[model samples]
Target: MRAIVLGGSFAGLLAARVLHDFADEVTILEPDNEQEHRTRSGAPHRDQLHALLAMGHDQLERFLPGLTEELVDAGAHLGHGEQVQFYIDGKRRPTVPGIRMIGASRALIEAHVRRRVLALPRVQVLPHRATGVRTHAGRVYAITSVTPGGDCHELPADFAVDAMGRSSRLGRWLEAAGWPAPRIERLRIELGYATARFHRGHELPDTVVAHSTPGPASNYLPSVCEPGALTAVEGARWDVVLAGYTGYRPTSDPAAFVNRMRRCVAPIQQVADLCAMEAEPTTFHVRDSRRRHFRELPRLPGGLAVLGDALASVNPVYGQGLTLATLQASALHRHLRCGASPHLPATGYFRRAGAVVDAAWQLSTTADLAQPHVTGPYPFGYPLVRWAADRVTQASILDAEINAAFSDVLHMRQHPRVLTRPRVLLRTARTLATHKITRPT
Candidate 1:
């Protein structure tokens, strides 16, 4: 069997790797030829700081054995427990033991994954722009491709994947081909962030990751403290990013970026004070979070699947995109492993993938709704949900046990509904009551 994957970045690479277990041959379609740790024209946010949530880290390791060791040996930091820090409204949360995360740039992590995936004998990367898929009797059989000079060709395949990030043309193609396009849901966030690299040596020697964002103290507004994150990435550099909503977004100005960092938490402030700026900051804007609901479609072409941003592009500030893609790929593998046919509509696969998307979407969109600038398409019973969620979050900062449960949900290892369990709610209430009683009036 032959499989074709569109886009060769993290999502497509993982899709190709998974397809290798089911198909005899797999080809990745990507136009950019750059093979280094740099952003490609196709992916504007490739160079930004990306987090591999604990579950994403586990999925990556499972897909590519020894990747953690490979990345660590190449200067990427592997942080566990206290080395990974989380702060809300400038106050650091007590560390939870056994929690692990890898500090690395999106580019570095993708480069390594690309190398490992391409090394598979059954897989190969192609320099071609995919136009659309060719369908016959409701099944995809070939993909139309165009060369650099506008020459068109076709590649036959038994299966195809659309990993074409946010700007994917699959929806249009489906409509043009007479199939009902999947319903799309969007939430306008108007989020913007800037990232810059600084030379690293002995600074924050024991730390690998530090992240700070708005909380109840600030009413989830950037006015109280700058929301940003810093990661100890490869090449002995500290990758710092500052984020804001709507009009308060960070800019590319070097001095202004550092000034914003100074308003952040202690770790980011330390980077601003001690580390010399390596270069001008780069900025990216996200106007909205979008998701394509393929499972809702009445009909879909067989032998077709979509992953990554093509399926769901949530708020990047939440750092859920990469992890969501990894989880989707795992879902795809399970669907195929069950002897599901590539020649028929992948109903089972879409069902499983949709469940994964639901989890990440709920987590990100719920938090994004907390921002003052964000308007509603609020979920059902949002007021009550928000109150309960806020209470749990406040308690998590004080108790390690509660934090672990919260972290499990944040990391995508467990469902958000788990927080609603009696045990968790009971602990949250007790913790909050104890803090309330002990505090000075």
Candidate 2:
């Protein structure tokens, strides 16, 4: 069997890797030439903050052994997820001691994985853009793509997967082919944020630190600090991001960026004041979290599967995109590994991928909707879920077990249901009463 994967990104690369176990030929369609340990021009978020959640690291390790050590050796930082100060509404949470995670730029992670996937004998990359899909008898048979010159070529396929991120063309292709397009779910969040880079030239006091302020003031003041990987490959530089909700936002001026940091996290302000600026602040457009429910549709295509951002995109703030994509890849692997059929079923694969998206979507939307600035209708179980989440955040600050549970869920290592257990609820209630919870000031 042969498979066509669109987009040679983290998700696309992983999909290619997974398909190698089942297909005799796999081609990854990507526009940019793969580069090692460098930033990706296609994904501007590479300039922003991207942390490899504990679960994502674990999966990457499973698929590519010693991958974490390779990244570390290449100047990435590896440490506990709970190794730093976590603040909410300007107050610090009693730090939880031991949840593991790795810190590196998106390019670093993807480069290493790209090298590994391309090393596979069955996988190959085609530096071209897939323009359209040619289907027959309710199944995709070929894809049309444009190469370097003004020329078009059709490549036949047994299976095709979409990992094209936000600019996915599958929906358009599906509509043109007279097939039912996946139902899209959207949560509108008009977010404005600014990011700037600075170099310390020495070890940072902490690996990662975040501070968020409760609104009802001027704007949502949420801040995050992530130092570059600890190795000497990249200097002691840190990525600082500040988000302003509603109409307020940060400035591109280096001086103003530091001033914004002074108002949020403590060490961040010092890092800003002392370090050298790498570049001017880059503004970010926080759009809606969109999910194309392919599983909901009674589809016509038999060999089509959507993965990664092409399938669903949650709020980037949660840091679950990479993890969710790989989970979907793993699901694809499981489906292909099914021995009963020589061909993979589209509906079954979509449903499995949808389950992974559902988890991240639930967690992201629930939290985003709770914010006053985001305009969205109440999801299935709103007020109760919100109330419980609030209590858990507060309770986690004081209770070690609660904190551990919360971290586990946040990292996608456990289900959100873990927070609703009888013991957890009781402890949250107890902590809420006895602990002098400071109202969001």
Candidate 3:
């Protein structure tokens, strides 16, 4: 069997790696030649800080043994959960001591994973842009591509997988081919972000500090890394995103950037003061979250599947994309091992993948909606739930158990069900009561 995967990204590569077990030939078609190194124009935030959740680490280790070591060898930082401090709503929860995570640039992670995938004898990566897909006799027949020399070619395959990022054209192609369009749900979030790197030895006190605005205030989330490097990401709602949103943008004027940091909460200001700007500030647009309900489509072409951002993309702020992609790949592997029907594999994979997306989506959307500037259809009972969540945040400050529970969900180790456990609710109530009693009248 032969398999062709579109988009040579984290998801595409992982899918190809798994397909190697079942397919005689597996080819990855990437549109960009520049991906040979630790830089990708396709992923604008490639240089930004990315932390692999514990669950992601587990999946990588399972799929590719020594993968974590490979990343560490490539200058990635390994830290205990407590090493990274998170301050929410002006309260710093007592850190959970032993959880471990890998922190590195998105490029570094991609580069290392690509190297591993390419080393497999059955896998080949062809640098070319995928223009469209063609099906014949109830099977995906070819992936259309344009070569660098301005020529067109068709690469035939027994199976085709789309792992292209957010701007995938597969949906339109499917429609043009007379297939029903995939169901899509989009959330409009007016989000803007600017990022810059700085020398790491600066006088920063914490490894990570996330300052969140409970209402309309702009917020900053900065990360400290190895090699004497640090990255600061400042964000705001779409309407006020320019100058008024975060009160600052990534500017060549270092003094101005630092001055804006002063407006953030305390620790962020302290970290901002210690470093010299090392890179140019780049700005990008962040719309809302989007998901293509491929599984819901009544008829999908046999031997065709979509994975990664092409299938669904969540808000990047949650740092869940890579982790979820890894989980999806693992799910694909499991589905193949079961010897399910060809059409059933694609449908079953999407059904299972939705559960993973739902966990991350709820966490990210609810948080985004908390911003006063963000507007959307609030589901019935959302306001009451939001109020309860705010109380949980308040309680997390004093209750170590509550903090741990929240962290587990944030890290993707536990499902959202953990949040609704009766013990958590009881503890949250007691903590809130204690906090109120301690306040001076």
Give lDDT per model, in order: 0.90, 0.74, 0.68
Tell me each candidate's RMSD, in Å, in order. 1.8, 3.2, 5.4
Candidate 1: segments with Cα more than 4 A from true spot: 437-441
Query: For candidate 3, what is the lDDT?
Result: 0.68
Off-target runs (Cα >4 Å) in candidate 3 are 36-39, 202-253, 265-267, 343-345, 437-441
Per-residue lDDT over 135-252 for candidate 3, one digit per residue giving the tens place of the 0 to 100 score: 7665578889987777898988788889988889999988877788888878776555555555555354345334233321112222111011222222210000111123222443
- The worst-scoring run of ten residues by lDDT in candidate 3 lies at 235-244
Please say which candidate is ahead in TM-score: 2 or 3.
2
**Candidate 3 clashing pairs?**
190-238, 200-228, 200-229
- Model 2: which residue pairs collide? 81-99
Residue 347's C-alpha lDDT in candidate 1? 91
Tens-digit lDDT track of model 2 for 198-308:
775654546554434442121223423321111112345666776665666565777877776776655566666677777677777767789897877776587778888
* Stretch of 10 with least lDDT, candidate 2: 224-233
TM-score rank order: 1, 2, 3
**Model 1 CA lDDT for position 188:** 98
- The best candidate in terms of TM-score: 1
